[model samples]
Target chain A: MAEKIATREAYGETLRELGHRLDKIVVLDADLSTSTRTALFAEKFPLRFFNLGISEADMIGTAAGLAASGYIPFVSTFGVFATGRVYDQVRNSVAYTNLNVKIAASHTGLTVGEDGASHQTLEDIALMRVLPNMTVIVPADARQTACAVEAAVEHKGPVYLRLGRSKVPQVIPPGLPFEPGKAQILREGQDLAFVATGIMVGIALQAAEMLDQEGLQAAVINMHTIKPLDRELLAETARKTGAIVTAEEHSIIGGLGGAVAEALAEDYPVPLLRVGVKDVFGESGSPQALLDKFGLTADNLAAAGKRAFQKKKG
Target chain B: MPAISAATLEELRLKARQLRREIITMIYRAGSGHPGGALSVLDILVILYYKVMQIDPHNCRDPQRDRLVLSKGHACPALYAVLADRGFFPAHHLKTLRKLGSILQGHPDMRKTPGVEMSTGSLGQGLSAANGMALAARLEKARRRVYVILGDGEIQEGQIWEAALTAAHYRLDNVIAFLDYNGLQIDGWHRDVKSLAPIVEKWQSFGWHTLEVDGHDYASLLEAIRRAQMNKGAPTMIIAHTIKGKGVSFMENQINWHGRAPNEEEYTRALAELEN
Candidate 1:
């Protein structure tokens, strides 16, 4: 079994180190510093950290102001509150002006577990990606979360980085450079492609192994950046594999699945299957149970791959 | 605080009248805008740009300069007029208010307009941004002040109270906010619409130094600002009681003019009143 680390934990640790290197870095939290791991940065840089109580809208607006004043502000909260609650502020204040605000929202998707539908965020990527100047990133695991933090800060404009709660396997090895708006092929196969983001990347790799045993060669691609998506790589995957399965711990409507389908439909027509939560809210359940219920497990990805493969044949 | 000199006050009053005239003309040309709030807030903008704020249009991007966020951004005609008069840009650019590809947007866009500190059109967000500016100032150990203006109706937004709490919680003493208490929103009278009565007490409870003044009185406005500046450890809110469409005879205290552009005939009458 591979070592597992929650992306939120990695985000916290990354912020602690980045705080030392970046003098202009400021962290704001709507009273979720400890949960979002912004507490780590708050501890290191007391003056630079601002805990804005439970005011998510104010936190986002304040981050925009800080960005306007030549500060790199990383605002952290739960994904639901950060994106859904403060959509107007994110759209008008940050994205409209193209401010350097990094919205690092953690505990997204069904992995929020027993916190239930209210806490779970299955629509954040869709919301953030639609905004004009917003950069949307969903890192696959702990190692990738660090790269996301670096990329978000180094990138001059606004960035929305989606992070998760439950511990997931670290598929990307240590010391791998993270390139924004680029896709990486983890495993090479020709029959079909499993393109995934966030925690589902691990599941897609596992599903590829399962398919290989069934005499079906599958390719696994990690697409970390959802917006400014690597259309070139997606086009190549469509041309080579001829079928595509997109998996994410989000709704099938407008996440990795929606993005890949849209790209493939426009650029390279192919049989595409979206392996994710159907268009419905999640319910209270254990993390593993929720993944299984939502058809977000490796088995589900393999099934989705086979379905897409069969469609290609048809 | 010492009284503003007679000459300075008279100069500002004259400048306020000129700005009011400019506001009417710009709105008349734009074909659509919120003239009532712009006229209501003119005196305050005139005082801030001409006397109070430590800013220079030439050094608009200077780090140490004082910041002003026009929170009630629907009244951006007032702000655009003041910014143009202060030489932030060519004065002729004022004619292009709300035109496509023009810097003078219907709302204050910091990216487009020169000397506009933070892009703001949405109500209730400016105070949060002001709090951020103050926080950044404190972080840099820079002794710069941040000024924000809010509408009487805008404070009805839940985000305003959220930001008020943030300013008070963080003890942003460098942030001074003004409420354009003109007593009217688009729908009707503010009291009838949603009673923000005991408004001063509300700010007092929010851990701020609160005061009320005649919004059109430059002396009283300056005095209140002086007191706010002298205070420490918390933010301040100056609820300036103003009349909507203050300088125009027909438009004063009229809720109908809240978001209507002045027609050609009304423009002539308004300009005549301001000229007088």
Candidate 2:
């Protein structure tokens, strides 16, 4: 076990460090600079940063305008406001024309505890991935968050980068290379495959260790890029393991689970179990309590792996 | 005030009339497009394209060029007519308004249409985008300007105020907007619906350089734009008062014409009126 760091903190540090190198990079936040960590960039580049005062729709539209004028704009806000509150602006202004705008959303999923369902965005991944010309990325840890941000800057198009509020363990080694739509296979197995994203990647890897003790060799995968999904990796992993379990800190309907299922159902049909929030709204609770209540724990994922394995055997 | 000669004003008026006729024919051909708002905003578009805006059809993508955003995109028939007349595309394409696979879509799409700066159909968004362009111009230290046209009814969306505050906060003097104050909307009169009365005052209070003018009058529109450019450190808003359907005798100020195409006889009658 190593020290934990929040992905949002990593994003802030990365943006500030990159701000000095990239002059064309402009950042906008909806009065959430302190919370979203855009304040770090704002402090360095005061002229390039725009604080749009709690108006998400206007913030998105303004970012679209900035992008249209040949500046790469990274818009920062809470996940719920960035996607649901301002969905039309993102769709029409940004995604429709495929502008070079990056929507970096923090405080996503059930881990945004105490704010409850209103603040927690469990469906942002589905909302964003459904749009054409949108790249969806959910980094597993602080190191990966930095990679995702830098990648988003280089990748020219609309991207939805999901970040978290809670501190999570360092799952990936520092400075691991990150490609836009590639998934990383962290652990190898044979009986079943555990596909996870965001915070759930660490949980899935822990669950793999638990399953390994029971003579069940479950492969663990970190599927960070949900859109332009690493279909080749998923297809190969699904074929190798007859059963699959998908884990995410989001709703099972349209989040990581849904994306994996769509791919597996299309390429190779396998007995699969989706581990996530079961289409129910989250309530105010501690992050650990919410994870335990919503069946997003390592133990829950291991159980799901066994269920998928048994179903495949049956 | 730069004295626009009577000859220039009259020529603009005739050109606007011809464009108005084109708008009628385009909507009539399309069979299902907005005609009232199109006609209401025709003269403003005409003046900007022909006289006010510094744009060349040959070098439209030039970085230093002035940009125009038709925020009230339902009025795109007017914009399309002007763009065609300016030789951005063939005038024959005017007949293909709203046609399948035609560049002229129901709403303004920048990717589809030439000389269109920003793709806007939903209201209350253009100003923020215009602000972005203005900011970009400022950042680049270019003398280019960004102009946007918004409908009175479209201002009901809350995003407009957000943009207003942003433009003033950023001191985007390079951006200018025209609020097409045509009384009619799709449902009814804007006064009876969501009244934006004390509108100029609202913008002035929001730290904009506000002006009022007759939208149909070419000279007045140009003069207002001149004043807007001189007022530095704040974005300008020209509340140009206009009739719903200005050229056609029958459709003038009529609410029903807001979204309906003229019938065959109505089209013939409208054309005859514009010609007169």
Candidate 3:
């Protein structure tokens, strides 16, 4: 309904704008500045920005060094390289000591089309959230991405902010507040709820609308902050609705789906269903084709919601 | 060159020997710690920390202070001993190497210990981190120098080369690293484990100001650091040749001592050798 914008674009713009205000902020990229959109910041803050070519491990370690020296260093690369490829560097260098390093990763999820499984990073959320002292954030839209970046700057310690490559609809309203460990409940319902994250937030909204026509009310939640999860909001929504379904562009295991299930089991157990990649690697395809093939579409999410709703009554 | 009196050099040597004894005792008390690398790198750390680096134990976190990131962090018994002896912590804390709730972790944890600039253990990442510290110092124009100690076998991690290129590319003259060429690792000799032959050429090829020296020699280590500071354009990598378990008679060049603590008999023998 509105001009679509990629969250990575917002992250880049926010970084460049904030570069003028925050002198302590430094940026580093692993030879992916243009693709990751860190070039926007690099152009503005030439002295403060470092282009570490094609070396993710060194980039992470260098960023850790900068952070230890009292600078808030935001290093950018793809989600696959930022989390999985350099997991040990990120863990030992940044997370272990609780350094104030921001790992803002773009081109996340299966939406990294035509790149195949090698570039598609469906398990980065799982990889990052498992580590101690790592704050994982997945912004839903461009406006929210700006809020997430500013919030990440204020929040100290290690952060893993996931951004997207493809342009997506503006799901959240303009100027909505974004805070760490808080979920935005965009739509309300009773029978079942679709707990979604990242690009799937828009799909969940469409699913909720579809479920309402069938006389089955479904709630839509944008669970952006995966780590330090908003457990209170999740449990509250779960109690109101007897069933829950999770949606994401990531693997069903160890992503938002897994996180929601873990929290729900601990707080309020409900009949739940997870809709995402079924532990299979993504392949070369268009963004829309990949979403449709991996069962990440609204029709698929609506089908999952109906199943969860029926299972709750059963 | 700053003329070092024979007395100062001899005193540094004796202090290094005493710290070696403490390293052995601490590892034995902890029941598990690396001894070979610690013994190999102790003399270099002693010369650097005691003579070369500008660190005030009282203001360990001062922005303008010099720092040393032990990249070969398994040899931290050497670093911990140096830091404790330098009064960064109580001398009594040297008894706790890897004990529970102790400030000294198995690897370096900057948050837990004073004077430890960076948390390192997983190898190859320290030089890159040191490069960051150097870059930060340049940005602040604090004249702060960052030093790094890396193991010969540890350089096989690939991130070390990545960092080597980085320091040289950035012209980080404020950074100086010592490659502890002890020639021995856990598996065997560096030749068998991973031959880092032509290592000096490797660093020079990467645009670093490379040099070779006897790591245990106090005058040579200090001299190399001085030259590194004066280089003005590139980071320096001094390939310091050393012996594994330098002060210990039986453990010298022994691979088994690479990651293990000494037993009662070995500890007694090691202490006796150090007393000389």
Candidate 4:
């Protein structure tokens, strides 16, 4: 049975587990400990938790220095400030040198709700994925987010774990094994495939169910790792399904949708429809309103799947 | 075995002089490098590497080693010279500075350089990095100390204060930061460009144990570092009052020398004056 879990809560729970195992693991937050759910780690290991105020750049630089000294530092901040505001520090101090620092950025995509475009980082995935030696992970939901955080701690080098702020409906079952670069096949279908990451995974699953009701079976694959993208799974899915609809709660350009297209274009050319935020910034609105306004709801995914299937037929 | 040996000071001063000469020659060869800041910081580098820091050039990656971060990284010519002089690498490799394929880049690269603790160029970031190193040492229950040097102009960056506040808040005594109060930057005088006046008080207000020192005076620099080591709970910030270009006569306190290499005639005069 598939268990429902929120990614943020899972992150908090999993970090506590990792904290007990790895004494060198320290958590730093930019005054959003409670919001990002890193407060859970603070509760468990108060000594290891450092609330670095609201300075994201300083937090990253400090994490870099700590990593250089052989301490595994996990810095948590909102996606907007972590990537957009501190690109130079992340590039030079962390990624350029390949420090053993993990940046767990929450409030990713439009799902962050009323905080709006100023807070919504639709381009964070693209920004972090482009950097060399940076492992980008956008887990499906809370259960996977927890598993991903655990996996990231074990993986060497720098990893950017993109997480959502709001309580997302969990689609993955509890205790399911989560790997970094491997994609999870939720439901297999012959007509088309809905490949998604982050919050879009739930929407993709819903769309798959809707397509099944219409007598056109659609498969759903949860692609959590965006940088070391599961090309093998993408190729296999494209070959099997013959059509792909890549969905994400990020910009259509240079995101999961773009990564899938790039992979398919090179190895397996397939009819694809990218279901995500258009090339535009979001506005202040509720999460549901924002998803509807941006055409990123399950209905949009279903329509995209149908379109991709038709394109394959043509 | 004298506590204050004139012969030992004289040898360190000679090493400083040699390092300065190497800085001039390397920059002249590269046709581009910051001469003013490099000359200003040469003495401090010589004193730290030779007499102050607990380090081994042969075992640069020793976990228990004291770390030194050149926060004012544009003045890397001086750091490169001192590192080469200390035998971190061959002295002859200084000629290939700023050239492609050489380990000695325009800015310090920790991976490429033998003894650089962190790759620093963007101002005000190094202090925060140093704080992390200090905090990590404390967390691991290690006794290693971290020393960072910053340009006077570089302190204008807001991130420096952020790190400063955090260090003081955490009471990271293992970290010591030195401000090269050269009063000059790439554009012009630090005061004229952006006033960082009452700098010592500002660091004190930020909760750091602050001290003032004559940066060019080896005894004062050494004394200040010693006092900083004795500080128990708070991070130490030493305001090193120095001339922008200390050794070269015409270049002293001159803003133009901040990033300019000495021309043939200027280099001849500067070299002769140092020899004297």
Candidate 5:
């Protein structure tokens, strides 16, 4: 098994190192510094770190003010509070104002586990991507999360960096440069392609290995940036593979699956299957149990690929 | 705080009345806007732009200039009139209020309008932004102050209390805020809908230095601002008691005029009443 690191852990670590180079970076958290790993940065830059104390809306609005004052603020909190609880603040104060606020939300999707549906955030992507000036990113591994942190700080305007609590296999190389709106292809195949994001990328890579043994070649592409959907790359990959399956640990209504489906429908129509949580709420369980229950595994991904194979364009 | 000279007081009173006329006429042309709140808050804005804030129209982007966030953004017609009068842009731009492609949006948009700090319309978010500006000032070792204007009804939002705690927790003394207590909202009287009585006590308990004053009186407002500026540890909240639709006789204290533009006859009468 590959070594694993939680993207949230990597994010906190990345901000710690990046803080040395970037003097303008200020950190804000809504009483979740320990869980979200923002404590790492707070420990180093005590004056620069502001613990806003369970006020998500206030945290976001304050970050916007700092951004207006020429400071790049990275606000950290759980995914639910970061997106739903402070939606209007994020919409009006941050995104609409076009301020440079980085909302690094941790513990996303069913993998948040045992916290149940209330704490788990399966709709953060849908919420963040719908805003006009918001950029949404889902880094698949620790190395990718570090790159994404640098990219989000350097890129102006609002950015929502979705992160997770559980550690996942490291698929991205440490030396590779990452940019928003660009897609990374991990494996190239022709029979079917799996477009995955966040932890699902590692799952998709494992599924491709499973499919290779069964005489079906599957390609794994990481659609890390959800908002700018890399339409050219998605179209080309779809054309080459003929069928595609989008996987995410989120609701199928509007996430990586929904974005890919929307882009493909407009630019390139193809037979596609979305492998994600169907229209249902999650429940309290261990991370592994929840993954197995939601069919978020290599076996389930390989099955989704086979199903896409049967979905011929009639 | 020292007493204002008779000349300065008379000048400020006359200037406020002129801006009231502009606010009424601009909304009447747009055919729709929040006249009541705009009129109620116009005097407070007059004092800030005319005397307190250090701003230059030519160098509007100066980082040292004191910032103001209109938390109650529906009152932007008043702000636009003041911004234009201050030469942030051409005075003729006030005629283009609410029109398509106009820099003056229905709400205050910083990206569109000059001299506007943080783009604000949604209630209960301004105090946090002000706290942010104050924090940034403290970080940079700059002495710039940040002012915010909020509506009485707007404080009903939970985020306001959330931000109230933030300002106090951070000790953002540079953040000075005013609550335009016109006693009316879109639905009806604030007391009848949801009372914020004991409002001063609320801010006091929240770790702010609170002052209650007459909204329209220039002396009382200026005194409160002076005391607030001298305050050292906490943000100050000035509860300026005002009548809804203050300047116009028919509109004064009338909830019916909360969001409507004036008709021709009402416009004529309004302009006549404010005429010297």
Candidate 6:
């Protein structure tokens, strides 16, 4: 039976584990402790935690300095503030110099609930993934978010880990080996493929089941690492299933949709349908209501998969 | 604790003169570099790299070694010259500055260049980076200190104050920042462009241990740095007053020379004046 786990909870647990093991791992937050779930780490290790007010740029710059001095600094904030607010600091102090800092951003995409568009970061993955030497990870659920946080600490360079705010259903089992630049094939089918990332992974899995009822077998692959993007898995899946539907909670431009298009355009050209927020801002609503309003639900994924299949048939 | 020897101070002054000449030569070779700020900061760079900072070029990556960040990065020609002269790299590589595939890039690249502590060019950022280093050093119980040089014009950025508040909030006594108060920026005089007057009062008000000194006076600069190292509970700021173009008569205090390398005739005159 698949258990439902919130990525933020997993992150909190994983941080506590890492904190106990590694004495040099310090956690810094921009006053969004409960929201980002860094309070878990703070509770266990009071001396190591630093609450840097609401200054995102200072948090990143400080992390860079800490990384320089041989400590692995995990700076957490909301996805919108972490990426959009302090982009220059991250670019200059972290990515440009290749510092060993991990930015764990929570409340990403429309799943952030009533906080709405200003809080939601639909373009974070696009912004972070485009920077050289920056590893971008979007875990499927809480369990996977924990796994991704652990993996990011071990990775040698800067990483941007995107997590959702709402309680998401955990599709991946606990103790599963999570590695960077590798994709997890949740289910295998031949007729069509539902490629997804982040919280949309569970939605893609549900959509696969719905498509199965319609006599179309839809394969599901969780492309967590957006930059090193599992090109081999995508290429082989495209060869097997003549169509692909990339589902993400980000903008269609320069995101998972764009990554899939770039991979397929070069290796294997397939009929691709991007299921994401069009060029529009989100609004104040519940997580489920916003998912429906933005066409990011499992039903939307099924529709997009069916449309992609029909285009392949033509 | 006492004053530095007179002979040693004179030797450092001569070395600063030589460093200014090297800055001119490198910029002239590149045909494009920030000469005004580089010349202005030559004395401060000479004193820190040669006499003040506890560092070794041979063991450049020594964890316990003192760190220096050139926050006023447009003036990197002088730093590149001084580091090369210190044997961080071969002195000959100075000629390849600003060229394709050269380690001597327009700005300092910490990865490419030895003895360059942090990669900085964007203003109002290096001090914040230094604060992190200081905080980390404290966390690890390390005794190494951090120094950052900022441009007077660069202090106009808001992020500098953000870093200022942070450094004070953290009480990072292990960090000391130097402001190259040459009074001129790329556009015009700093007073005309964006006045950072009462700069000492500003730093003092921000809770930093503040000191004002003639940047060209190696002894006073060294004493100020010593006082900063001895002080505890807050970071220190040394507001270094200097001439924009220190050694060259024609380029002295001229804002046009901020980014421009001297032509053949001017370079010849500048080199002769330095030799004399």
DockQ of each: 0.83, 0.82, 0.89, 0.77, 0.90, 0.74
Of the two candidates 3 and 4, the one with more favorable TM-score, higher being better, is 3
DockQ of 5: 0.90
lDDT of 2 by residue, A1-314 (tens): 89999999999999999999988899999989999999999999999999999899999999998899899999999999999999999999999878999999988999999999999999999999999999999999999999999999999999999999999999996656789898998999999999999999999999999999999999989999999999899989989999989999889999888998999999989998999999989999999999999989999999999999999999
In angstroms, give how far residue B160 of model 6 lies from its true place: 1.1
> How far is A143's C-alpha from truth in model 4 (Å)?
2.0
* Comparing 4 and 5 on DockQ, the stronger one: 5
Give chain A TM for each model in order: 0.99, 0.99, 0.99, 0.97, 0.98, 0.97
TM-scores for all candidates? 0.99, 0.98, 0.99, 0.96, 0.99, 0.98
Clashes of 1: 0
**Per-residue lDDT tens digits of candidate 6, residues A135-219?**
9999988777777888898899999998888888778866767888889888999888999998888899999999999999999
List, residue by residue over B43-67, the lDDT tens digit for candidate 2.
Answer: 8898888888899998878888998
Docking class of 3: high
- How does candidate 2 score on lDDT? 0.92
* lDDT per model vs. reference: 0.92, 0.92, 0.92, 0.89, 0.92, 0.89
Residue pairs clashing, model 4? A6-A142, A7-A142
- Can you give the lDDT of residue A23 in candidate 6? 91
C-alpha lDDT of residue B74 in model 3: 94
lDDT (tens digit, per residue) of candidate 4 on A183-271: 98988999999999988888899999998899999999989899899999999999999999999999999999999999999989999
Q: Write the per-residue lDDT of candidate 1 for residues B88-151, one digit (tens) a residue.
A: 9999998999999999998999889999988888888898888889999988889999999999
How is the predicted docking of candidate 5 categorized under the CAPRI scheme?
Answer: high
Error of 6 at A32 (Å): 1.6
Judge candidate 5 at residue A129 and give its lDDT.
96
Query: Which regions in candidate 2 have their CA more than 4 angstroms from the true location?
Result: none
Q: Model 6 residue B233 lDDT?
A: 97
lDDT of 6 by residue, B122-203 (tens): 7777887898899888987889999999999999987788788889988999999899998888788778888887888999
